[model samples]
Target: MGRFITVEPGINIFVEDINPAGRKTIFFIHGWPLNHNQFEYQYDVLPAMGYRCVSMDWRGYGNSDKPITGYGFDRLADDLRIVVGALQLKDFTLAGHSTGGAIAIRYMARHQGFGVNKLVLIDAAAPSSVDKQTANEFITATLNDRPNMLHNLTNMFFFQLITGPFANWFMQMGLQAAGYATAAIMATLRDENVYSELQKIVVPTLIVHGVHDKIVPFAKGQETSKLIKGSQLVPFQYSGHGPFWEERERFNQLLIQFVG
Candidate 1:
């Protein structure tokens, strides 16, 4: 856990910066209904390997301020911009997972990735309607019972191991997110189209997808790779939605290699 810095008046963003001032910085944007903890494995391992890891719990998730609104990509990208400027980071890898992937894409497209060196997408939610499980299911489950939905989704799709401790920990992370924010984000993802903007990003990009990812299909990763010029796609054959957790060592090493 690191300090909570106020990026806006009443909106403080929680950031965990590991091995500060290390060789290079990697700013990690976590998945939907999740936060900095989603990259706990990466933050712990990469820093010791001489690469600084910066993970932020988006404004309504984890230890950050949970307001009633501001769940779209425009605000999320600005939040990331402010966080990067606050840390005075430059030439850093901007990585995102799932919904965070969509946010990263928008950031590059809209903000033109001012301080970013490269891009990484992990089990990313696609621009169009590539989510196989469908947003309707998520909306229904969230509206019905968001907490229980996380438990069920975690056990059924999130991980390959599906052990008691791992699933339980993931569920806890998902539950901590603000319900209003989660609901609003889902709706935005459901209606918004990021496909048209992918061509706008010209930075060196990497797409990492678990082959068994049920939530966001591996084909979507392929599609995204096709859309971006000179982008590379890596696969974790044995993992699920979370390769950083399911295949921690390989994921970290691949990231290091990509940035190096």
Candidate 2:
């Protein structure tokens, strides 16, 4: 159910479309330095509940084409626009995690939320959560020692105990991405501000953030919720940056209730 879609000339994004016959669709965009496969648990359960689960690996990550340039949020959002149009999606729920959530916000502002009816931001990196200094440190660390940076990031991803092997596997997802692209995206996270974009969102939004999240502080989610009128904020007390996996059951159930 996965295919390479040509979003632009010389660039093909890897898209995974599951349970195509389902009544409703939830399109997922993953966080930074990881691909669509990051939502493995959700993909396993949603399709069985009569929901079509669609996910795509943005360029320079996972199975997608890794180009040298075009890592800006504007261009990334544009890529999403094309893919949605190609799939003929309408009124689908758009779910984005971390950096993907920021890009999704940009898409809402830039494309006017073209095919999306609802928005879900999970541990999103927005509302000026990541400061410039920290982002610069990350970019420097990534350029200097990429493996160690990813290793440490994996350790900070979840509050629950994750096995050593599992941590390695998760870190590998970051390794799969291009080094320059990873840095470029981090730069976008550092330089770009999404507060105005968040205010422009008109669809019903669900903001799910881990109360103990180290990557994106819970206060940022609060700020994002305030900016987007009528957006609901849900805090996962036991999780860290990745509530979708750390608290998969509740996360999936919340998605079901909101998307329904």
Pick the TM-score winner: 2
Model 2 agreement with the true structure over 1-260: per-residue lDDT tens digits: 99888988999999999998989999999998999989999989999999999999989999999999888889999999988988899999999999999989999999999999999999998887468898899899899999999988988888999998889879988999999888989998888878888889999999999999999989899999999999999999999999998999999999999999
What's the TM-score of each model vs. the native? 0.95, 0.98
Would you list the C-alpha lDDT of every candidate in the order shown? 0.85, 0.92
Determine which window of 10 residues in candidate 2 has minimal summed lDDT: 125-134
Span of ten consecutive residues with least summed lDDT in model 1: 127-136
In the predicted model 1, the residue pairs found to clash are: none
> Model 1, 131-194: lDDT tens per residue?
4257767888888899888887886565466678877788888888888777778887887758
